[model samples]
Target: MGNSNDLRSKSLWMDIEVAPDARPLEGDQACDVIIAGSGIAGISTGYELALKGLAVMIVDRGRIAGGITARTTAHLAPLCDDLTSEMIKLRGEEISRAFYESQAAAVDRIEAVQKREAIDCDFRRLDGYLFQALNTDSKIIDDELDAVRKVGAPVHRLVGVPLAHCGNQHALRYPRQATFHPLKYLKGLAEIIEAKGGVFYSETIVREIEERKDGSVAAKTDSGVITAKAAVVATNSPIVDTLALHTKMAPYRTYAMAFAIKRGAIPDALYWDTLDPYHYVRLQPGEGAADTLIVGGADHKSGEADDADLRFEALEAWARNLIPAAKNVTHRWSGQVLDTIDYAGFIGRNPGSQNIYVHTGDSGQGMTHGVAGSLINSALILGDTAKWQEVYEPTRKTPSGIGNFVRENLTAVKNFAEYLAPGELKSLDDLKPGQGAVVRQGLSKIAAYRGKDGALHARSAACTHIGCHLHWNSFETCWDCPCHGSQFAVDGTALNAPAVSALADVKTGD
Candidate 1:
């Protein structure tokens, strides 16, 4: 809240600085593998490859581990967050079982890595509760129980969780699910990677990734180029593929808030509901006498909503009703997740590229997907075989998920049609300080923002990803593209990808 133009809000995990000594790339470089992002997936992949004695160079447009990973609630649940029942309907039982196995293995990999590296990031195994929301049908719990069991996960049918007003609620308890301080874990992992000869470059933007005819991949950045035997695009949204992968997934904006609570107020476990946009709750052990209760929900398609305050209010009301012991809010922020039509990450080789690989499509399970993708992509890069490869194949198609595919793609169609609609404001004069609006000007839609300092910043309302219309996200104070999850700063710099370039500036007669 200090400077809305800089950052709208800070996530609870942003306090930790990762790879503090890392510098931006200055010139041409070479490595066995070049990673385009430094999030959990990128760092974990680097750790895996570096352990094998491979020279790894990781780069990011921002600070290391400062992307969406820092904004996540750090839930390491391996079960399908979108509902295993629905996933089973889209993917067969065999594939669904493999998906679960891979996700669970991701959690296991985190446990193993933390132990091996002696990283103390509050890593612990806990029970996960998927209970029925108040007044909602209990059949979701039953169906999930059956579907999860079919996937060979250890789930127990139970009644009620350790929350108020949920004494008689039907629930499923999945043990061995995990949670952690993502920043701390990544910080330790980054140190370990560096210690093992892996290099990290923060504030390095990879503009284009190309697989050269010589069988090597080159990541072109503004500073220079990085050549490697292979490359991985771990950016939250893959910037390499324009249409194929983008069409298979949709972006969602999810909100989370943390509240102060007594250490023993609520059990240390993961809690989620059976609601469509399910509520997820967990506890983080604090240094002082008070612990932190983190609750998240109220998801909507990115760029489709600008009601984060209302969403936070809804979350607070729901949390207070269920856990009356929750105290004052400590931190509140939001992150974006890409939901795939098939409910699994797209990990492994990028389609049509031999030396280039991609890891994306978190599907609301970014933590697990990131670790699992690290393992899968690292193996594939090392010329080793991964058993779960087919489960997360980037090029694979789910014929059964056709309905979901159509439903999600319709968002783009509707978004494209918005280009013809009138802007939110007729002129920039209608904008007030600390506010932003799309203004119609001479047949062009301009994204206009009046800063708190009385300065006006204007750019094209069209997203550079595909020229789809951009919408102002008041909560995050950024422009969100409804088409493929590209986000731009108020000053027109692209924050998230599928779009690397900044928004085109509008010519204003001053």
Candidate 2:
């Protein structure tokens, strides 16, 4: 459910051979629990359920781990994106500390599983960084440091990070944060679950979920239906109907571009900017047709930004400024992050619904949050009231986060209002120098655009990969499919992977 027009044009996320095929659910299946969306979260939850000796069915709309998990920049840090001090203020100190501990514990649990299962997903335990480079002499540093200390993680001040003229002088570096090939981890876990008699169905889109009188839920798939006592909506954004889950978590759109680089670009330790639209940088040892430096983060809400290439150019300029030889941007992509109104994620039942559960709003901490959500969802379905559950209750509101709620929600309402204004499309003659509009053609959906010279253009809005709606990525001047990694040029030609097909002819003068 992302901007598909610009999305079907780019191949993103350190790609590897994790095979996923659309399969029909055969026969009426009965399971103790059914997990939706087979990304890191859903797969991890399925693996846990299988280990607990419960019959489980893990289903995904597309390939396994192909959603936000692949689109992710893959930074697993306990820093919580916003300053941890802000988290302590938004949520209580105890809840903030629990959030930090849960992330650390997720890393620990993932590492332990990889050791026991012997899965090689390049899971490395590196120290995570919250460096202050731009706003160096700022109080954010002291505030973040204070938050770090309160959370029980001893962070050492990196006094000697040698930089030439770039003044990222002081930073709070915490030990034992991690990096990994997310697909490899999830795919490997899926293998283990199947070996233990759990089922994983790729391309198995769950269209509807019905809760029966006895609280048993029936997951309606295209091929057949699955009857499970409990269901977890682990799809990156919870595809199932969830009350207030969507509103509580706003989708933030961020970009990542990979440039070919040497092995020791930044040396293992991950980096993120502390700016309004922050950029996060890391190195992929042996990912693509070439080794590349992945720089991500130029965040906006899902449909907000009006241009994407400028953001890419901005990242390029930043890299050139930081590391002069950074060029050959081989991979360029974007992914949506579900950020919670409060600092912590909502990981329990859907407010009033008894059998339904959701795991979302990780901010940018999905890697750890998704894994932790898996653990939390399992505990919740099993009726095991763990202490962490209180911190992540889906329905729980933060008295402390009221200020944050007002600010973020007001921003949302402001942005959402743009959709209701007078149409940006002022007929073909009145089109802008370079812009696109969604126009309905009978039963067909066409993405209409004007070129740099104001020439008219049009093409199919449906992602050739799977039929998720495409949003106009004004930032990229391309169509972006939120469901998977696909982008298309303004001309409607496919520029991304997993969707090799090009667009249909435009219906000009519409």
Best by lDDT: 1
Candidate 1 colliding pairs: none
Candidate 2 colliding pairs, count: 31
Q: lDDT tens string, model 1, 161-225? A: 99999999999999999999999999999998899999999887899999989999999999999
Q: State candidate 1's TM-score.
A: 0.98
Q: Which segments of candidate 1 are over 4 A away from where they belong?
A: 1-5
For each candidate, the alpha-carbon lDDT, in order, equals 0.91, 0.71
lDDT of 2 by residue, 90-148 (tens): 87688888888888888888899888999987888887666666645756767778788
Taking all chains together, each candidate's TM-score versus the true structure is: 0.98, 0.84
lDDT of 2: 0.71
Which whole-number lDDT from 0 to 100 does residue 67 have in model 2?
65
Span of 10 residues, lowest total lDDT, candidate 1? 1-10
**Per-candidate RMSD, Å:** 1.4, 5.6
